[model samples]
Target: MSPLVKKSTGEFEEFDEQKLRRSLKHAGAIPSEIAKIIQQIRPLIHEGISTKRIFNHSFRLLRRYSQECARNYSLKKAIFELGPSGFLFEKYVAEVFKAKGFKVKVGVVKKGCCVKHEVDIIASRPDKTIYVECKFHNHPNRKNDVKTALYINSRFLDLKNNKANEFDEFYLVSNTLFSKDAVKYADCVGVKLLGINSSYGDDIQAIVNKYHLHPITSLQSLKKKHIHALMSREIVLAKSLLKQKKTLFELGLDEMEIKQVFSEIKNVRRSYE
Candidate 1:
């Protein structure tokens, strides 16, 4: 289809499986990572699913994956399933801070006043620690807004010890284009609001530009590439096995029995790959 005609359809032109896959690939995602993400959203696949819808669906699945697995799994793995964008941004944000010679840890579990919350990215120096919360949502809610404020305010004192520390600062990061009200609320609650492609405090663009971040595309690609590679390698290995000599005696089988082993291996590989 012509580019103009595709645009006229009111659907995003680059929102399908192939496009998403390419985006992910371009963003430097591995195949296995992409495949795991694909598995998470496979049940939702349908004939008419658009690329944009697919991307969004994959993102939601990633969030679900992170939230569910964070408690039990390693922080990096949970974040890996979250998709490239979140993973990458979280990574480089920490990287940028660390690049400046700071101590940084991604996905730190901290005790909040009412709950144990996983802060997206944490940076610490000799004097203080900074808590950063990252968000990429279509909309914001009042309840969530209030809770964020409480999170930051509550950060001043350790929930466990009720002691104040100088190393505390709250940074609320978002990919959604922030609204004036959202900025106001963030200010009212004493949290700094940051938006992708927009200035937050100072040199915000410098950091974004430095990383050249594309979270969704990079993540989807990594997942697909890793899984696809694994599938491909397994296929090659299975094929090689078929060409090799067969051992019938292992199963105490006759001549006909050895062929069954060959067939079974091929079938198993086919099913998995």
Candidate 2:
């Protein structure tokens, strides 16, 4: 057999269950559970089977052993699933801010010196106001580079006069990691960051866990088509999807899957809560 290719990017590489093993371990699976998952999925590893399939299979099996590990698995794609653009992430961030007691508005356009700029999020409280930029990425490996940091900082600076008035601080939030230079600039220039590799060091999962803002696209009981079907309707959060269980009907999932996924969603919500 030739080398294996990843489903996400079509890059071919050799299979190593050790990587899966390590990921499960890092996600808090014990050694015995880790070995069991690798042993089960190892045979499915061969030429042409996408690593994404392998990963989904591994996560499915891993869930039976450790739900925590399964849920903590890279949540980057869930936010990625939210888009044609970063709209869903922006909405989700707004939801997070709402949960944190900020009055939130998305796609805020304001006059800078020369032109108008749209802020991804504007959240105000009785005490302070903040503006936010959400940097969404599909891949966990894709980091918010320094260029992004500089551009966002400049955008904040241009809006610093705040013609609308408020916003004591500006924050950049991302579903993926951040570059070293991005973090450095943020620290030096005082642009607050809430990214995976942020200087402030907040885990997106931890926020999701705290606020129960689980992404519907991460449901393993639902296949890619099922997730996509929901995403198409702007149903990105698990909390929202499970509320309208009937929406799952049009996604072409059978009754069994519907029931199964509702159960998974309940468990996922419980995990986050």
Candidate 3:
């Protein structure tokens, strides 16, 4: 194995298997499977090999043995592929809320004190209305920071100031982590923040598993661009992928690719069910 490794950013850094092992474990791979993954990919590590290559190799192997772990590890990338439109993320979040028994509305527009605010996602219950601002990041290096918390909190305040009879709490939900300052400000101001890996809870992984809300990008057969194209049409879930079968061809996936994609979808559907 080479000491130096190429990062996704094109930066070279020392290889640390501990970080790799930690990531595999975090994705819910069992100890034995994690060890097997390292053993399988360990030999191919070279000084100049892109980490992407290493990851793809390991993911292929992991997907064979543990679809659950592979999909969990791919969660962020799956969400990233939903980009060019954050609305898909909002819809995904809404699905999670629906799974939890909330009546969710996406892109809800309501009047604010200073301006008209189109809230990203909203959930209503018998006793409360949950106003949500969905912040989505495409890369792991980025996080929901203090400025976002501040801006969202201000928006919450404006919404509250309005006479609109809504919302017991204002929440900012992201498929990423929050900065320390973001957490601090939210806590101080009583604004709830829900991030994928947030310490404050609303664990995205737990919610996904609970709701079986794995995104379409979890399919190993779909490439990044294919995912973005599907997402542009607001297709995010595995179920949606099956329903909008024509969208696959519209995205330019040929016959072979489409067949493979459907095959992957079948496996994914089985795992979740």
Candidate 4:
């Protein structure tokens, strides 16, 4: 019998080793490293083993093999580190859209048909204008619910009704997953949804990996205060750190720590190259 693994949500499901293999492969782990990691992990699989433990173990081992691959694997967790509040997340989302060639604005208030609404993101090009509402959750199991979909859709509707040709698209982007009802409601109302693994091809993970938009928090060397300092200076992306070496000193990192951070950032950037 397959050992049942406990999810972060307190639900238990049979462990699927193939899932782990796929994740490692996606993270750029070589065949030999994947095989070795699996060999070590198999013995540790027992009934009621938490997924968190498995992830931590795999991450530690993967980091030992390749820092780049480990950073790729940690992308989801790194995103969560962007916020206790959703402000940094909004900035990050704007950056993602900017990478896709959209002129982006964050936290802009636009007058709707009824009242003014402060949209999380406003991405525009000569062709189209997109309004995006970001739903960022620190916890993996916390999903964007139907109410969230409805709320964002209603706001979009108001804006759309105000000037139908003003915005071409409205998207609800979440750092986590969406509830089934949320997805259904979004599809029904024409509110496009983007989450960790949306049925839509342009999910958050896909976009991040495709554009090499990995956040600064992806670096394991940085502490929470370090992240805060960097973000305060509007330094969000890991690759951006390469150009701002002096900022690392401003964060109070010693010479060796700064070197280590630069090394890790280089490895992360090299992965996408």
Using lDDT as the measure, the top candidate is 4
Error of 1 at 97 (Å): 2.4
RMSD of 1: 16.0
Candidate 2, after superposition: displacement of residue 43 in Å?
14
What lDDT is obtained when candidate 1 is compared to the true structure? 0.48
Q: How do all the candidates rank in terms of lDDT, highest first?
A: 4, 3, 2, 1
Better of 1 and 2 by TM-score: 2
Writing each residue's lDDT as its tens digit, candidate 3 over 1-273 gives 547999988899988888888877766678999899999888898888888888778778877889666666677777776665577888888887878888988887889988889988889878778998998777766888899999998899898889874689998888778889999999999998876645565788777776668887677788878776776777778756767768788878888988888778676557666
Q: Show the lowest summed lDDT stretch of 10 residues, model 1.
A: 213-222
lDDT of 2 by residue, 216-240 (tens): 7677777887777777786767778
Model 4 per-residue lDDT tens digits across residues 1-273? 799999988999999999899877756789999999999999999999998899789868888998656554577788888888898889888989998899998998888999999999999988898999998887776889999998999899999888633988999988887888998898998998876655554777767777878899887888878888888877779878878888888778888998898888777666667
> Any runs in candidate 1 off by more than 4 Å, and if so which?
1-88, 112-115, 138-161, 164-166, 210-273
User: Against the true structure, candidate 3 has what lDDT?
Assistant: 0.80
Using Cα atoms with residue i matched to residue i, what is each candidate's TM-score against the true structure? 0.41, 0.72, 0.75, 0.77
Candidate that scores best on TM-score: 4
Task: Report the backbone clash tally of model 3.
Answer: 0
lDDT of residue 155 for candidate 3: 91
Residue 271 miss distance in model 2 (angstroms) = 3.4
